[model samples]
Target: MRLRLLLCVLCWLGTTPALAAENSRVLTTIKPLQQIAAAVMKDIDTPALLMEPGASPHSYALRPSDRRALAEAERIYWIGPELELFLQDLLERQDSAVDLLHLPQMAVRKQQQAHNFQKDEHASHAHGHEHDHGSLDAHIWLSPDNAKVVARYMAEDLASVYPQHVDQLQANLAVFERSLTALDDRLQVRLSPLRDKPYFVFHDGYGYFEDHYGVKPQGIFSLSHEVQPGARHVNQLRQQLQAAGPSCVFTEPQFTPRLVNSLTQGLPVTVGVLDPLGSAIDVGPKGYEHMLEDMSGALADCLEAL
Candidate 1:
């Protein structure tokens, strides 16, 4: 009887990997972070995503459902207040939240001021909030290397929460790292042909990717992610667009293309869509890689046409 009981106990222990992790109700503010966390927590848990697809984090108003999710979440992961300005004070109230922006070894790109980028739309918004990024560009996840760092940091965090799944989490992170290397090599080979090919972006959110891959844009229409350029700024952008002739102009899915189209009309420019936030991408292990691949494809396709 004792021997039979010992065998049953061992079988139950072995089956624990298939069970839900302890305190696994993880929540992430954006799709990319959710994707990263999902990859790290593979086989153990799937983090609940807060921001809906096609929603702009910069301008997203929290719904009742989102508020409920926040209330119930055991742990939360987000970039920081700089990118998701809407989540600043709310996150301060959540003790379980982890701000990945301040993670060790993060390479934050400071916002480079264009003489044309004088007006910050957030400073003069309809909402009476003044959001100064402290000149920090919060689009850090666009860098593939940054994605790896995020996964590493995320794995470390998850390991603490679910110590029972530590081995699986570490294994998931290793798989993520190896897969990232393969994706980086492929992106380099694919985007290598379009080096120095000038392009224009509707929003200045691709600085991290551009800097990482050496495919910088020629000019930007707006400095803020969620605002349209004013008439004065539009005029300046038009002059700049006219100067950057025979190039490609990229528009984002989250914002309207009306301004971009108007500026590029009658100019030797091809308009292309670049989804910086990967709003259309489904949350999964390959979400980050797919976002970079999609952006690189859009760039190469548009630039090659010009």
Candidate 2:
């Protein structure tokens, strides 16, 4: 009886959460990052999403629970100073024990590479708002290549913390790569039917998607929401619409589309709303896949209608 009891205790100890929970606590700043972490942590528990769905990372205020989570987190992932400026101070204040990964920093060096190319191209880009010196577009995960980089980093982070599960983590990453590849293939097939269709966006936020998919924007209403276009610029955009032959004018959900309506007055131009922030979608537990799918479907719909 004593021997049996001892063996039962050992088995229970082996299966307890204290033994398995070390690698389970992951915290990510945004929904997209959380999705990448989810892909990498397939068999593991879902990560705590710091910024909830429909919340803007730019203006997210931390709650008391969020503060505690950040302080106690074993691993945290974020895009860095470009997008989540608010989290900079909190992140900086953390002690040395915490493991944190900055996705934009680890993934791409676009700030250095794209500057020279864009300098001459955007020489007169003075709408009002100042650009960051390094000016890294924190929106790296928007690109499939960058998403792969993030997945790699996530795998590394998981492996580092839980070397015992390294094989499992790598296998999960392989599955993630396969899934992302399949998603890209599906997007390519859907987009093949509308490659030549041109559109205008309220902002130049679609550069990553456009570059990846070879889609072109005929005109941009603005670079950032901070600045409104001048009267001359608006009129020029209006004239471009008139001459471009019924291109889709994409507006943001948060922004008013009245300007677009006035610009293409009496014309049959298609005006569609594109939410780069995944604003319109639910983006809850299973909503991440739906969000990306909807974006692609929305673009396809707009292009087909054109």
lDDT (C-alpha, whole model) for all candidates: 0.75, 0.65
* lDDT score, candidate 1: 0.75
Model 2: how far is 165 from its true place, Å?
3.7
Model 2 spans with C-alpha error above 4 angstroms: 1-24, 93-134, 160-164, 223-234, 257-265, 280-289
Model 2, 69-180: lDDT tens digits are 7776778787776667788888867542222235344444343222322222222332223345465555666677677777787788777667788987888888877777
Give TM per candidate: 0.83, 0.73
Q: In candidate 1, residue 289 scores what lDDT?
A: 76
Per-residue lDDT of candidate 1, residues 1-306 (tens digit)? 999999999988854422322224888888888878878988897887777667777678986657767777788888998778788998878898888878778988776544344554531331112334457777788888899999988888777789899999999999989998998898888788788888877555787898888887776554333455566766667687787778888877654566556566788888888887788887788777787788788889988877
lDDT, residue 57, candidate 1? 75
The candidate that achieves the highest TM-score relative to the unseen native structure? 1
TM-score of 1: 0.83
